[model samples]
Target chain A: MKYLLLALLPVVTQASEITTQRQEELIYLLHQDCGSCHGMTLKGGLGPALLPDILQNKPVEFLTATILFGRSGTPMPPWSFMLTESEAEWLAVYLKNPKHDEK
Target chain B: MLSLSLFAVEPRGTGDMGIVIERANGSILIIETTHNSQLYRVEGLGDLSHASAVFSRDERYAYVFGRDGGLSKIDILAGTLVKRVIQAGNSIGGAISQDGKIVAVSNYEPGGVKLFDSANLELLADVPAQYADNKQSKTVGLVDLPNQHFIYSLFEGNQIWLLDAHNPKQPVIRKFTDIGLQPYDAMVSNNGRFYIAGLFGEEGLALLDLWQLDKGVQQILPEYGKDDPKKPVYKMPHLEGWALTDDYALFPAVGHNEVLVADRHTWNLVKKIPVHGQPVFVIARPDGHQVWVNFAMPNNDTIQIIDTLNLTVIATKKPGKGVLHMEFTPRGEAVWLSVRDEDKIQIYGTEDGQLRAELPALKPSGIFFTARAHQSGL
Candidate 1:
């Protein structure tokens, strides 16, 4: 029953542990920094929404790639200089299941 | 301790007030600028995400424009909401007429400009932004011109429109269809002569002369980035916050850590000064001597002060993680900067760059003073 319950639990996972400092930076980058165009809550604005449900069909790798390289011909700018591949990977996973952290 | 003598003191009852937008909670901190302190807070201001406010000529009435198409008029003295109206689903910003009789809001949702009665927030006219065969384009880069005319750019359609609201009922509209593609932000000169539009779809910007509107749009810096490989553009720069010095204009270069200096009279590029990061606001001091510039995300921590005469980054300071906006005192003695991550607004000496005083705020972005009432192109 424990295994079954564990298997049935929603998958809210991160690729790696983000340090408290790094996590705080990412939260600010996601909430307040990215909030300028992506909406304060990551819903939608000049750019599209970054909500998990909105990006549910997309792969975590795609989200990480988008954050790293940014979409061309769009307002989304590359953050490869500011974020590492691993950190972006973590953000991708967190974004996919962002509800894990309640605002 | 910073000397209190250097601080700007509010001349008693001058009504020198401003609104600081706290985007996180959709609230604004009404501050008395002369005192450099908060007077009151108006909460639940409705989608202040990328918001702006313009003061009525009397400096008593404030027209707060929100991203969620909210138009709110608040009395600065009473710190009370005069009236709040949500005119559209999404909006960029707005402009109040020179005469201060009409208020125009620029929209992105339905793609048009709406004129309202400045007194009561009544819808005066709804001009649709239709272009390119049955398509409604998002309108942006809007500004109020003299003679009761409201001017704006059509983002998707690549055109500029001017609305004459002299009658306030039946308005005549003029369209400049060949201005440029994707004109993001525009600004009218402090003298209200030149209207320059920054383009994203192309390399250069489109220039319009309100005095020479009959000549159509003229292109300047037409080859700004055509030969060079463009860097990654983090956030599109808004020209509204750019600076215009005595004979030169300092504009943030698109997608690069550079400020493009141009000769105002000749309307030609002079030089590009490399800065810390992608420039956002390159606002000149009221004296038109030194210019202060802020950067876009990741590098937004530092602000570079540029010397207008020598054209060099004279001073650089990192106030906090995200330095959003800055507003100078009417005399340009002390400048107030909104340090977003630190949740504090720092008043720095414009000359020595000394930390004067810090006022606590809640995730602030834009800061506008009531003194804007006496200025142009706010």
Candidate 2:
């Protein structure tokens, strides 16, 4: 039980670390910065779409790694400098959800 | 008398009028420079996500190119959408001909350049960006030449094609192959003599002399910033905003925090001005006395002004976040900047660096003026 609690402790802390304000900033970055290459509506442009339907095949971990490390040959640059590992993970999860409106 | 005067039309000229793109929404704000105020918020332009505008010779009609391949003809005088057509699946931008008769759009999905009658938005010609194995390359950097000629670069095919639409329906094409890898965007010089394409996959720029087509395309600054370690580019630098003076031409160095200044005649690297961030738009004021530059991504909140005579950064100003674009008035007296994140348009005096006015907007991206009607590669 103590080991399980320790394991859950890290997860709880990690999830709580992303404040509501930081979440808003991340969403803004997703829509504006990432939206620059990927279409503002996430439909697709120079970069591929980040929509839930299109990104369903990509796992959360895979998308998180791509967000942090970036695709090497492509124009997508790494965001590890600005984004934390968990923040990128959160963005990947948010992108995979189908709640975003086209607008 | 009041009822009679209400129906009477106020005579006005469209030379002072311009369009500001509300990129998030498919709408445009019809604005006038004389008053620096919004005249109308014209909506229903589809998917203006990455839109650009080209004005007709009369400065009355604006040909708006949208990301969803929407070609909208806006009547600025009446503040209405005159006509619209889905010309392609996905499009980047467009250009108007020297005679202002032809309007050509560059596409990405089923990549090609479509020529239209600027008068009624009628299709005149279709030129595909076909390369090896019948694979269509994404066409970009479409700009007008002096004689109904349109030049554009291919991304996947790595080539630049010059289209002579003098005979609209059956246009003549001159292909320049193996120019470089991934010619992302291009621009014609202010005088329309030189067309330079910024290569995304490499460190050089491909230059074509419009007068000497026989000379072919030349690679300039192939080894610039070669010594510096490659930094990740947050946003692609727009060559459309490249600055050119009588003595020099200024371009944003990709993946580096520097702006490359080259001799206009020699095309040789003259100096590299280290800037605040990865430079996006390095634009010069109309008078050519000072150059204004904005950055991409995290450093986007700041704008740096460079003195053309000294080649030194004269001043740096923080004009709020998401400073997507800047446009100077016809004679360069004042410059207008679009602060996208703050949802406002900030106008500053070019000489004083003082805030002149502020107007409300919704996620503005590009601020274009009617003055571009007279310029070649706006």
Candidate 3:
């Protein structure tokens, strides 16, 4: 029983470490790329405000699509080429639950 | 005798100068045309924002055109916003009638001119402009003409439209063909005889004979070297400079960087005097012998002084970046220049070209000064 518990603890630690790394990467990307139009905090700039709680109920898939395809008839231009599909998906997840696992 | 007083904002690095004359009884209105807008009131000048700032013949009210298409009327003596008129299209350019009864604004999206009753900010009429091509139009420049008429310049269409506001409900539109590649601005001489328009694609001025619109509009001679076509064309005529005098008409040319002296009677480009880079706007001193040219500099900021008598540049003073527009006090004691990129208004001595004061971080696009006589209810 003791040996089995030790093995499980190592596996749990590794998963948490990976999750932390991904969160850091997502925040860095948003600050660098989106800060110009959207405020660094994503409050608002030339673009509309995008607070975490306000967007929490929004579908992650829809958020990814908007980021990749962009809103037509507005100043938002498409960023499909700039971001990979997986990266866009991660951003969507982060935006939808911005306060998740707060550091 | 002319004197200069400088009003410098404490911290220097802010850009652009946005200033307005107050309509309230005892204060002046000044705003910084920056991303972060700041508002100021002149102690004795009255509340500028409350005044309907139309330069009408009567000079009683201020006509305020908001960016969101809100027009307001302010009573000068009462220092209060008197009325709010019907909303119009987005206004980037505006002008008041010579008689001061009408206000005209150049709308952006709908791409036309909207005339408003100056006293009430009431919608007089909407005159749709005709474009040579099916292009989205941005009305960039407007000038008031004599006889209840006004001229508007379009950004996309690159044309000029003359609107007759004689009947506010039905405005007659007269299009001047082949005025220039892109007509950015138009100015009618005080006498109402000659109208000069500026081109963004050409190197010279477009001279229109108001008396004879049927005759071909005259393309005033250009002063650029044939090889340099890419140098941005003169964006506005009389941009080089214009002084209100009964006898002679003076204009500045950006391409040649010189003031073009024209015979008011004959409407001929009699001579040209060389000036500095991109002379944005000019103000004639009350003496009428010297017209101040705000020279827009790429590397440095400076104002070029021109001797109206000889049509030559006499001196240059460094004011700061992006000296795009200027206003002379009605008394001609000081000249207020909008240093756009720097976001400040630099006040200068009209006689010696000295920096008297600087108002930093104003995103000012236009500047105007009310004549003292007009203020005195003359």
Candidate 4:
């Protein structure tokens, strides 16, 4: 039980590092800024879809790395200048399991 | 004593009417320029995330091209959806032919241009973007030429094809391959002669003279920004946003914070005007007195106006965040701007640079007017 609690501590700590307002802003950036290429609904456009089903096979670490350092040959630009490593990881997790549809 | 009739039709002209895509909701606001008010809210358009519109010749109807391949013809006078058809799996935009008898859509998914009978939205012909191994490439930079001719660029195929669709069933396509690395978008000159495509993977633009098709695609300003460091483009520059004057042409330099000005006749690089961030849209006014420019992310809120006579950015205005698009009025008296984050369509005087009016909108991206019906390559 102690190991289980220890294993979950990092995930909670990473997510809690982002404030509520910053989380909302990140979500807006996901739907608007990232949506410019990936479609506002994340169905797909120039870039591929980001829907859970489409991204189910892609590992979260791969997506987070791609988010931080874009693919070299494609039009997907790097977001490292704007996003931190942990923030990108949080976004990657959020993309895999979106919670904004709760409204 | 006056006799009133319930079936009497109101006398009106559609030149003052237009449609604004409510992008998030898949709805449109039927608006008029005179009153600046929405007449009706038409709904059920599929995936208007990157929607565009083209007006019929009569200006009574608008054919809306949605990102999800939904082609809808709306009656501006009646304020209702006349007809709609999912022509492809995914589409970027569309164009209306010179004769107004046909409508051509540029698709991204199935990778081709599909023509439809403008009267009733019936599929007429399909020109596939075929290349190596019968692989498909997304079509872009679609523009209609003067005599039922259409031109488009293939992004992945690295080619441009001109389709002569005089006959709805049959088309004579002229393919110009090896044009550039990645031709993202293209535009035809106002006089209907030159077709220029902006390359996404290179430093210059691809040019083709319609009058002299035998020469093939010519590279212009092949090294405009060769020495500069390429910045990551948040949004690709719209070639349709280029402005051509009598003696010069001003367009955005891809991945660079500059607007390249070239001689109109010689196509030689005249000067590189340093600007704020990367310009996404560098459009000219109707009279060619001034040019207005808007940039990509981080600097998207600012608009810079240039003096065409002096070739300098005379003024700059920050009209709130997310300045997605700008459209000049018919006579160039005023320009309408879509502020996405602010949820407002702000109007500004072209000459004075003053806030003329403001209209409420829900994340408006493109603000197209009916006046585009008569313009070439709008």
Candidate 5:
């Protein structure tokens, strides 16, 4: 039973809900603006890799919190002032499974 | 049956040499205006997370400023790096003196400004930007003046500095402590006569007439943003406020999807042009007949063309997703625009708005040409 649950964990986790317009906007933000520092491919530049393969190991809750309240002492500015808690969580979940958005 | 052919020797002096920032790779893609194609790619400098370049007086040497405290002097003619220096932990941008002798860098980490010798990249003067109980603040909006002076604004300090690098031995620095509010970004006029800093803490912007520095700072557009309450500012808009054409100029209404046109002589509000999104770069065409604009993000893909005479948006085209920057040819005959996600730069004819050519690039951000060498406050 434990082995079966582990096998389904990847597909069970879903991206936070967002509107179509908001999703398009978020995807553009992730690629262009953030891509200015992070790699356009999300492979990492000044900021660390935000790719799904690297992000999978990190906790989704922690990632969502970081998106809202940016890392201090680094170049990342707090996005909560501009983005909502739900929106930040949506971005966090989407980053974990970037290819899922295409489907 | 075919005759032997040889290529033209690359000119030592500037014709159309320029650079495009490859942010993710810490390199620059070189191109000439004539070919509209890539000449070479120079890399291995340092961190270029956010980078900008300024050329020498002769337009032969290019000074590349990287965000990771790296400054490199590259020879455009030889296509090689002359010297490199790690100036700061993080830098926003830099400026070059009129005489081409001094180079100034604005830094974020351990906030301050550093002046370097244009020849050897040697440290000449160091001004630590400290204020509000000795807290070092990030510096922005650094521009060059006709004399040996360099002007920049501090974000946390809420101060604007005018440094006189004329006397290399002993530099004279002036601090304008009171400038209304938060000085975010700044730019000089086309002729290098006026230096204006955009204030984010409040509505108005602080303007300093470089011709008369002792006259002090004056406030302009005091209630620019006060009237609009619903406009949501996503990312901080770059405050290169006005695009001067003929006797008037155009300024973006920061967070709002509108642009304010004002008179150059009287400094009076002329018209407010509503755009599709929050405008970032409201640049005037060289011919002074049209203006081209791009947005911050989310709405960044749409590039709009505004008629200078009519003061209205003449045309709008969504070039691809992630349309980052647009650069006009020297005579305003063509425009080179970058679509970052597509990894391509499309050139269009200004007269017909028709796509002429497309060039491939690797995540390009800023497109700077050597022709800016002869200009001021790039």
Candidate 6:
């Protein structure tokens, strides 16, 4: 019974590690591309600053839609073709849990 | 012999010293300095060209000074240029003698001011403006003083040199030391009683009495705490625009967004009026009741009209983007402005500040007007 439990633990931990790595990759992408005009640290420059408090609780679908179709009358252009649906969803999830640094 | 050289461009056919306006399209418009005459369009060679100074006693001949030291002599009537003179230096600014005999060019480099014969393009004399103690003596301002002498502002050394131009072969230097920091630009008033020195990176304009150099004339500066060295004395931030009338001297502060008006007699700050962004050049109208300021910016270009009597901005006109330098015809009917970023020369009616016409694509940087009568041909 103990050997069986040990085998199951390794499989579980490996799956969780992969999922965390994917999330981190999405966060890095959002910071690099979206952060340019929106503010490097996602604060804001030519575009409105994106705060964690304001965006963290936002709906995933709403965030994804806004990224695909940029705000009008502003410099933000539509990035629908640049990011896949999955990639956009990943960013939405990352925005929700923006406090990765928080213990 | 007065001659007319009309280059296919339109000539309003009014004044003598034609105003040169470099347009946004990299073309130049040459209009009469005194009257609204035919506008001559000339081809230019540069990303953005400005006619810094224009020299011509008669309308038949006009010499234009550019930022990169590209000088061209244009025939007003024919509307075609006669010759192109390219010297080795960057000309910050320059002035021509009253007789149109000598042209003094100021260099931003350590190389001193160069005096050239206007007609033949001969180097009459090259006065070395380098400082012996320091290697960085950049000459910034050049103006014609009384007695055929030229006053040059040495920026790095913070001094002024009065050069005797009586003999073009050998020039004599009269040095006025320790004026201020970065003496960038200067101007001699209509009466020639005072020389207003625009000092960059320093507080106040250095008012030098042409008659007495020993007792430094009053420095028209803003009030600053004696103990606080960092506090600006007169917050006319960047020493960009310096102009003078018979009664007052106007210094525009680029950083502080204000214009400091000083009494020409007392050399004291009479008033400080708020103005637009980065006022680069100020021109006193012949009436002296108002002064026109060209606000320098990459975008949102405009000209601020200051009511000199009240010492305040009466109005602002958005002519175009990148309005660099401006000049009024001797007759004051039209005001020609060099639009650098737009690459065009814009003409405005002096009375109402209305856009009369737009000449596109002239890389004009510096400009001047000639009032002499037009001749048939050069």
lDDT of each: 0.83, 0.89, 0.57, 0.87, 0.77, 0.60
Candidate 5 ranges with C-alpha deviation above 4 Å: A1-32, A35-87, A90-103, B1-12, B240-242
Judge the docking of candidate 5 as incorrect, acceptable, medium or high.
Answer: incorrect
Q: Which prediction has the highest TM-score against the true structure?
A: 4
Q: Model 3's lDDT to the true fold?
A: 0.57
lDDT tens readout by residue for model 3, B135-251: 556665576777778876665575667788888778888876666765555666555666677665566667777788888577775543344433332133334234644456666
Ranking by DockQ: 4, 2, 1, 5, 3, 6
lDDT top scorer: 2
Clashing pairs in 4: none
Q: Best to worst by lDDT, what's the order? A: 2, 4, 1, 5, 6, 3
Candidate 4 per-residue lDDT, tens place, B117-148, comes to 99999999988899779799999999999888
Best by DockQ: 4
| TM-score of every candidate relative to the true structure | 0.90, 0.94, 0.61, 0.95, 0.83, 0.67
Candidate 1 per-residue C-alpha lDDT over B1-378 given as tens digits, one digit per residue, 9 for 90 to 100: 355753654434535678899888788998976667899898878888788888888888889998888999988776789999999877888988888988889988777999989999999989889997889887888888878887889888889898999977677899999787688888888777888888887877898899988989998887686656777776668788558887898888887778999998988999989899888888989898999999987688999999999999888898998888999988889899999888989999888889988999988889988888776666
Q: Write the per-residue lDDT of candidate 5 for residues B109-175, one digit (tens) a residue.
A: 6688999999999999888998877798888888887778888998877788988888864678899
Q: What residue runs in model 6 are displaced by over 4 Å at the alpha carbon?
A: A1-103, B1-17, B21-27, B32-38, B44-50, B134-136, B214-218, B222-247, B298-300, B372-378
State how far residue A50 of model 6 sits from its true place (Å): 36
Better by TM-score, candidate 6 or 5: 5
Return the lDDT, model 1, position A21.
73
CAPRI verdict (incorrect, acceptable, medium, high) for model 3: incorrect
3 versus 4: better DockQ goes to: 4
Per-residue accuracy of model 6 over B210-314 as CA lDDT, tens digit each: 777666645567342123333112112223224556677787653455667777677776776767655667777656666888653322377888877667788
Local error of candidate 5 at residue B191 (angstroms): 2.3
DockQ of 6: 0.02
4 or 6, which is superior by TM-score?
A: 4
